[model samples]
Target: MSFSKIFGGKKKEQAPSTGEAIQRLRQTEEMLNKKQDFLEKKITEELKTARNKGTKDKRAALNALKRKKRLEKQLQQIDGTLSTIEFQREALENANTNSEVLKTMGYAAKALKNAHQHLDVDDVHDLMDDISESMDVSNEISEAISTQPAFDTVDEDELLAELEELEQEELDEKLLDVGPSVSDRLPDVPSEAPAHREKAKKVDDDDDMAELAAWAS
Candidate 1:
């Protein structure tokens, strides 16, 4: 029978063979490894050139060093990617059955997704640095605000006025307690009555003296 007729007269859709998938992953890993190797070599060559140039063109040398550093960072990332791919391929190969293979594949896919989603170390460091600086600035602002002087509602003039009024009230209360009222003023003294009494007494004394003298003579 023809191959199609034997399989219900239709060509069945085939799943990717595990061996083929592992081979493809290995090929991709090898390519990444080659890229990483190239970048490393380029970085090493640039560093050597920078060192040989010495301090003559310091700015150029510094820029070359920076470029080398960037290349090295990229190389490291490529190496990590290759290693992860190789690991995943090995894991897929070791799965016992189809179900296990599927599970492993799913896990590998999820891990790749997560790797893509994760922030780079440099980004995380920069974010943390920014947050720290912001906190420091906020603290400084708060301290400055706390140290600033507060506004006073009553000034010196107003305070002195209130004090003067209180003193005046106290003095008035004391004067009222110590001083006499209008009804308690001294009474008027007798002057004419004393003169009249002296005159009357002198007249009586003169009459008595006359009578006595007449009798003696």
Candidate 2:
């Protein structure tokens, strides 16, 4: 049998895409909303008619109520239809989301595979080892460059002791220089302030400073 005959001479109809299905459902919902509004208006009008004709025209009032009942039934059916469409649309959206996520995951897997094609675990380890060894060699070279100069040949203990002695001498000179200023400041000392005792101590300090200076010179 020919292929066309095997399939009843008809091409299979393709199902709608998710997007198209959702859009169609939305359109149907809009149309149903309009239809619901129309039915509600008709029912309201029939109710008004029945109310206006109430005792004066029994047959007309009954007819109006019957029409209202039919319009209300149609409105209920449209509400049910709207609910069904909303449920279907939400389901389609979720399916589309899952499909896109799955597609992206597949693409990422392919990319990861391609990226690792030229890379080997052993080669990576070897590269890292070479880098670490080079860093160690560079650190050694830096240490050699920054080693202490010829100053290391000198005695640090002797130099430090001499430095301390020089600092002490400078401090003594400054103290002697300040004595004259101290006397000038206290020209009129109070009697009970032990001014004579302070003067004796200053004289001894001056004598000791003079002897030290003469020895150094």
Candidate 3:
């Protein structure tokens, strides 16, 4: 039997509804926000304890506080991300058609791109949202493309020329950073025999005789 006949004969499982998926996303967002809040509180308490301690322990406590503060900042970013995802889920929920969905997804994509531009924290949730949105848009685009006429001609020579130019430009940049070739930098090796040649030759002959005697024994 063909592979498609075996696998395609079975009915594929239905995916969850958009509302159901959005609810799940919202729950996850809430959970992350709560965790972030807890981390923030813990960091704050540590900072307070450090402030009350004596000078000797104060330095150590302060270092701990700094570490905790860094963690708190990360958690705060997590909270922000959760909020952003929740917003995206809400937007997706309200979207009716593929076009509407695309619009909402575009908003999420733009938000993520802006976050990257501004050096904001990028979490897994943001990445997943971007990917999910892009995949949905891509499927629609692919479907549309499939309905259109296929192109028969491609300018391979033009593409090859562009590729060659790009490669040459990269080689040029690399050559600019490299010094002159080894032949230009170093003197040529001498062809003359060394003054110790006879002594060295005698040492090799003696070692060869010792090896021959050992092999004979």
**Number of the predicted model whose lDDT against the real structure is largest:** 2
RMSD of each: 25.0, 18.6, 41.6
TM-score of 3: 0.36
What is the lDDT for 186 in model 1? 77
Model 3: ten consecutive residues of lowest lDDT: 92-101
Please, what are the lDDT tens digits per residue for candidate 2 over residues 24-141?
9999999999999999999999999999999899999999999999999999999999999999999999999999999999999999999999999999999999999999999999
Look at candidate 3 and give me any clashing residue pairs.
Answer: none
> Lowest-lDDT window of 10 residues in candidate 1?
145-154
Q: List the residue pairs that clash in candidate 1.
A: none
Per-residue error for 175 in candidate 3, Å, reads 99
Off by over 4 Å in 1: 1-15, 96-217
Model 2 clashing residue pairs (backbone) = none
* Local accuracy of candidate 3 as per-residue lDDT tens digits, 116-208: 885635666798899999999999999998784557566899989999999999999998789897778998766555747877999999999
Query: Candidates' TM-scores?
Result: 0.37, 0.66, 0.36
Write down the lDDT of every candidate, Cα atoms only: 0.86, 0.94, 0.81
The candidate that wins on TM-score is 2
Cα lDDT, model 1, residue 12: 78
**Candidate 1 residues 1-217, lDDT tens each?**
7877777775677978777788899899878878978998899988987997779988878888999999988988887888789788988788536767788999999998899787788999999999999999999999988784766345889889999999999999998998797667977667788999999999999999999999999
lDDT of 2: 0.94
- Predicted structure 2, TM vs. truth: 0.66
